[model samples]
Target: MPVFRRRKGNLPRLVPELDDATLGQVRRRLETSWSRGSLDTSVIALVARAIEDAGQDWDRKAHRLEVLAGAAGRAVPDMWRRNSPNDQGAVLLHAWSDLLQAQRGAEVDLAATRDACHLAADLLPADPIPWTLALATLRLERRPHREMSAVWREIKARDLWNREAHLQALAYLSPDECGSTALMLDLLDGIRSVMPPDAPTAGLEIITLVRNYHRAFGADGRAGIGAGEHWRRPDIARALDQAVQDWLRPGFLTHATAVADLNVLAYALVKAARADEALEVLRATNGVATPWPWNTEGDPLERFSHWYGRVGSA
Candidate 1:
């Protein structure tokens, strides 16, 4: 069986290590779905996870989803095509959501998008992807806060611990977007309070902190919370410490997004100049790169490799 062999400079392609057989299964599943009309919840779920594993580069990620969605749509039988609520109907909704996300920067029709999402929600009443997509579209379009909140509530009502939904909400609440640092922090606090310490989202607080820190301080290492000791705010430090402790334990955050969470933690620790802590995270990551905090500084894997070298030498 083949595997995703790790290399130091595979920029934008770093992902969790998947053995050849498992990876082949995922590929075959996707291919089969595209060839025929196997637009079930399982197919959509697999595609959703693939999107997450593609890292945070919106254009690249969107393009992959666009292809899958388009191919799946074209396979639908013409006799069964009026968007009635069914498995194929849900997939069609996902296709619309994908196209909307791909065209995020350009002018979009909000009303039509919302209608599509609503129809998706009706089709997949139990699935959280539609709700997550709604939150993402609202974030991209910079829709009203109340509207975002309403959709957020709908998501939480369905699956409170949905990682994708929380991520979408986190991006919407970041200082660079609709929310300020305080608002983002508050959102983290609320999530932390409700989530168990071992839950996958236990690492989100640190991710949000890192995003806000970068937002306040430009890409340059200078400014904002200051470098080294000065960067250690009590609240942020406490949150990071707790996240680190929880993350290091056995069986913690054994989800598909585990590597992404670690990527955020490692990036945050490096920015804070906590070399030892960052090294711990890097060691755990084993060179799997997820964009997030490192995209602003050029190739994420390159930055990760540079920092790993510095920490190792130190």
Candidate 2:
């Protein structure tokens, strides 16, 4: 017998509304739907939309759905017996939601995120969303190269051009003892090619590439001077400064691409000894709390603070 075998009776439906009371009501009903042991796809989709409408307060609804999704993933045989496509979709949606929450400074469990990603991978083999999420979780956990190598192989076997995959790969392949510059640049070029013209990601990739180029080849090489010295070059400084300004425009705010670009810009400015401008940019960017996941770190914050502090003393 399936865990979510719908009783041969009337099924409960969620009420439509964007208000708090209505959202609350819908959330409760969805919980009940999950408790019945059957994954309800329609209810899952509705709940996802409702949570999105709630914006920052989506946490409450997301928590409830995440429990249900986990249950469905664990009870796969039961879900299959119940013929519950909804249950499957609910699992993926809930995982994606949880991953987003974790990316946000929330206290979500890494194990849960990994499990969700694995379930999503099995359920949506053709979909890049699950693979992307899984790769991200692996990177966050800082798995060994052997483990990451397998994940990277899977990604490469599929669509190597996916934005999320490329971005995640960029982060995973750092310039530290673990990564190769030639390989990283190749990945960056792939990322650059697929970036949309107006997308802030294009600018962000350019900055990352430039930074890495200098790091690998040194200031005097073909990539030009290091950021610290490049500011002395009027043309180079002007171009970078303009790119930073373009990323700060109102239309680009709240985008992951913009956040990455701003982070790179902040670093570039600091290295160029423009502490005041760096501080101003960081302030405008909300100082590290951008909504988009994937690249949230304190390194930029610490570096900016140190740079500004030193500038004040000087």
Candidate 3:
């Protein structure tokens, strides 16, 4: 893992940490390419090498693609596709990056993206990434549930426990995206009882409940509170309790995305006014924090830092 940090004596300063050191190296290399205004064979080779090395490891592949898609300039994938017109990596990267832009309110050629996903599927038929990104696309488009389900079936056939696959399904069923609260709760019912405690989605129920907790309060994550606390609700409390009890146990959460679930646990604990309980989970993260759950409240780093102090001083 490549460390990016700006630590103070007691403040929480965290950055993204990739389980693959090479991926972190790849990101730094991409940054250098972008800085030098050079997009060359090295660019294509490095990106493809990372993807190829990820091979059929669906979870790591998704994480690598996400890091690339997020770290890359839109032009990188476009140039790769233009030069290596039949490269499967280029097709997957282009479509995935474009879909991410679309989610952030950017306008894109959705039809072309769909075609690229189809191309990626045919090029690497056993891989689940193309279909997973397609699931993300369908979610952004607010496409009908039936259509999303069809895409999901495609992903499940390739990799049933794919973290991003189930996450997309969770988001698609979430009220924040397309589904109703009742619908999101139904999805939770399907997940909570069965998802393995150490799976990529270890803290999934906490995620759903936390999002629903925010929905009650408004988009800014601090709007409504008329006497009762959502965190104190019977079922929500139990879910948090389960996460704290199991997630911190040694040997659990061996997935590539374990840090992400740990972040969810820390965030939920703090949000539920159990900041002290989050200390162990936060330590397990080892200074890698994600922007979700915290982002909905305010600057993610600031919020996490505040809790770091709150939990520490206590």
Candidate 4:
């Protein structure tokens, strides 16, 4: 019952982000707003409703806010903040959208964005979303390590299993980002020692392995060389084994972004030449798909469905 379905109408719908019936409704509203060139008041009301729907569930609130921010038209957040400066949702969305834009090579006012984040954290001290966004912003800016660590501490202090917070950390410490390979590996190792198999971070290790694999071969020869066999290497194969054995356990990954994490795992399993394992994971998605690894191929849903078709009867 996802908002988006595949062509030929077979498998469950595959949205680019984590979604449910409630979020589906919010997405529809946002879609309409976009079609009509929505102004701040209209979009803000819709986004505010979504935030209220999230209640006190930090994970759900974080996911909803991030999704809505990404889905909003580029000017939406700026106007929202400008018009509704006192609303925490607008403040956070403004910062979050700026972070997204900055990641895509756009110029953003980091200082003002940082101020917005601090103001948001002050407005809702219990919520980790602001700090999480701040962590990402700090990462993108390649600010001092102590600054990154400080923001990270605030996020973890609020939501210990914050998936986005951990993701930002991984990206920040990545070789392509501010940190080195050894630092990234150390971060992964630290997480494995303490994090449970089913926490929101269950997909972190697999993501690291997959991204590192791609970083090595890259876009040039990944498709040209012995890609299939590359995944069967001892390290990657072992990581896949761990993910398959642990992540697929029912009710294990219960966080808000669980579906998105499953998509990552399913994509990794597919690339690892483990179609059988991938099938089970894909079915668990119930048609929810992320625009990640699959997007690396083409249209996310199309690529995902192609793989699903290849292994359907398994």
Candidate 5:
């Protein structure tokens, strides 16, 4: 199950430090044009931003995502009626494809979602969003592994470095969910092999390790990791060292989800008793506390602050 859940009264909020001004502007713009016809490039970009933000709070992000997608959906029929479905319509359809999967909340209408994704892909042959959505839908629907591999090929053919696509692929191959640790590691190695040494997507290796670590240790009886677990794996150590270098490279910090990936890395380093290494990752975060790894501890912001404080005092 997801780490975040309704406790007593109020729903969980995202770690405040993760607020991004640029994405906030995109959201505000979409909100302002809620009733307008025809979508813009910024609308599609906002959808991407929303997908990135959902890494923290899926339900809250879905609510905001539907608001923007619903507006775009309302405009699409008229746009298609006037000039045939355009790029904007393609993006709106892609957004709906995601919104549909999100709305179902684990009980997705797989066929409907797939059809929507295909329509969007046909409308905009070169866009990666549709393929990414297809990948996500397939994973959610628990479709055949072969089918997901086919969709992943489509995504990689369009944009090899698409971070969202990679995340979905990882989810499909997660040990606890569908695939095994060996398969997950192979996927990471395959992507890292093709990507440039410093590509932002290379950070995915570190993120996957962190995710897998939590999946194993967070189990009901697991409580804590033992000495020989993933935290001490030689492969994880090497990946962490390489990922830290790649993460610190200039220009990589611009990705919408870079800070979240950094947060995962920092959490892993701390758990592995490598706080000295984690200090640099924490420093790179610039105080942005993503709601993950920390969410497992409750009040993600305070947990992140506690770690950052320990790193500082060290």
Candidate 6:
């Protein structure tokens, strides 16, 4: 579970201690960190927090969101181009989808979400998040029943972590299924394994899983099981507050993971009806500080820019 410390008004100021050259180096490292298939998870955690802490400054938050998305996009193709599949690439793709999905419902594009899920599946066959995303995308698209069942079956056949499977099951199963509770618990176990060691944001995946479970089952049923579980508490509003803190704590943010973590956390919070917190996180990151507007105005070269703008706006 994430460490939840109340934010005292007395929280220490965030001093920018890095010199320009050092800052540039850090940025470069963050931008390219995914090439190795692993990323500094803490860095991403921090980015999420920074965005959350940014509060109310849409322009700044937007800029930060763009930067985070741009870096992730640049690193994504490298995952597929390599001879071996990279987990970070898949993670980044999912991260992008998480970000896009968090936007106002009207702004979401099923095609883009589908593309992101497909990319993630191609990059990390072992990880179930992408497949789950694909299923969710199908649901969003209102695909026919047969296709949905086929997708669900395919997901079930994979050696996915239990929580992922439970999540998939929750997405597709009827509530009366006798073993659903046990399945969710098993899913929680899987999430525990994936939590980053020594990072506040480690519990995020579990939080997301439980939240989704609740959405599928309602507060009195599956959602109420972990009434007080650190990450699965029924009090979604408080959980969101804690998630923001975990993502922003000084030790958690890193360049490579920032955008992805922020995207996921923001989406989760918004879905839980904590849009105010989500907006605050985005603003704190100075996301809109950059003047380039995702570094694209027009033309093919501006594809990255366009993505950046969309990410920020979302």
Q: For each predicted model, how many residue pairs clash, with residues at least 3 apart or on different chains?
A: 0, 3, 0, 0, 0, 30
TM-score of 3: 0.88
Writing each residue's lDDT as its tens digit, candidate 6 over 121-226 gives 6764654445555666665555665766676666656633223334445544333332355554564455456655334235445345545545565433444444
Candidate 2 Cα misplacement greater than 4 A, ranges: 1-118, 121-127, 137-164, 206-227, 230-239, 253-257, 275-283, 286-314
TM-score of each: 0.72, 0.46, 0.88, 0.88, 0.72, 0.32
- The parts of candidate 4 lying over 4 Å away from their true place are 1-14, 37-43, 219-230, 311-314
lDDT of 1: 0.63
Question: Could you tell me which residue pairs clash in candidate 2?
Answer: 4-37, 4-38, 41-86
Q: What is the C-alpha lDDT of each candidate?
A: 0.63, 0.52, 0.78, 0.79, 0.64, 0.45
Better of 2 and 6 by TM-score: 2
lDDT: worst 10-residue window of model 2: 9-18
* Candidate 2 C-alpha lDDT tens digits along 1-314: 12111422111111212123545565566657668865565664565564445332222333333333433333332333245444434555556556656666677776776686667567646545556667777776677778777777776665544445656677777665346666677766665566554542445454654556356555334444544455656755775666667665667543323444555666566556677777555544433322111123234334444543433343
TM-score for predicted model 2 compared with the true structure: 0.46
Which has the higher lDDT value, candidate number 1 or candidate number 5? 5
Where is model 3 more than 4 Å wrong at Cα?
A: 1-11, 17-20, 219-228, 310-314
True-vs-predicted CA distance for residue 233, candidate 6, Å: 19
On lDDT, the leading prediction is 4
lDDT of 5 by residue, 1-314 (tens): 11122222112234332445544565556556654644665565565555455443322333334344544444532333235344434444444645554655645456766776787678667766677777877777678999998998898787777777788888888876689888888988888778876454756877776676666666221655463366778878887787777777767655556677888889888777887788778767766777777878777878877766554445
Compared to the true structure, candidate 6 yields what TM-score? 0.32
RMSD in Å for model 3: 3.4
lDDT of 4 by residue, 216-236 (tens): 776333664567667878977
What's the lDDT for residue 183 in model 6?
Answer: 57
For candidate 3, write residues 1-314 as lDDT tens digits.
22213344324655454345788888888988899888777887898999889877788888888888888869888888888878898998899889878978899988789889999999989998899888888887789989998998898798767888888888888767888778877866876677666767676677776677666765444643531377788887888888888878887777777877887889877777786688778766766667886787778888766665544444
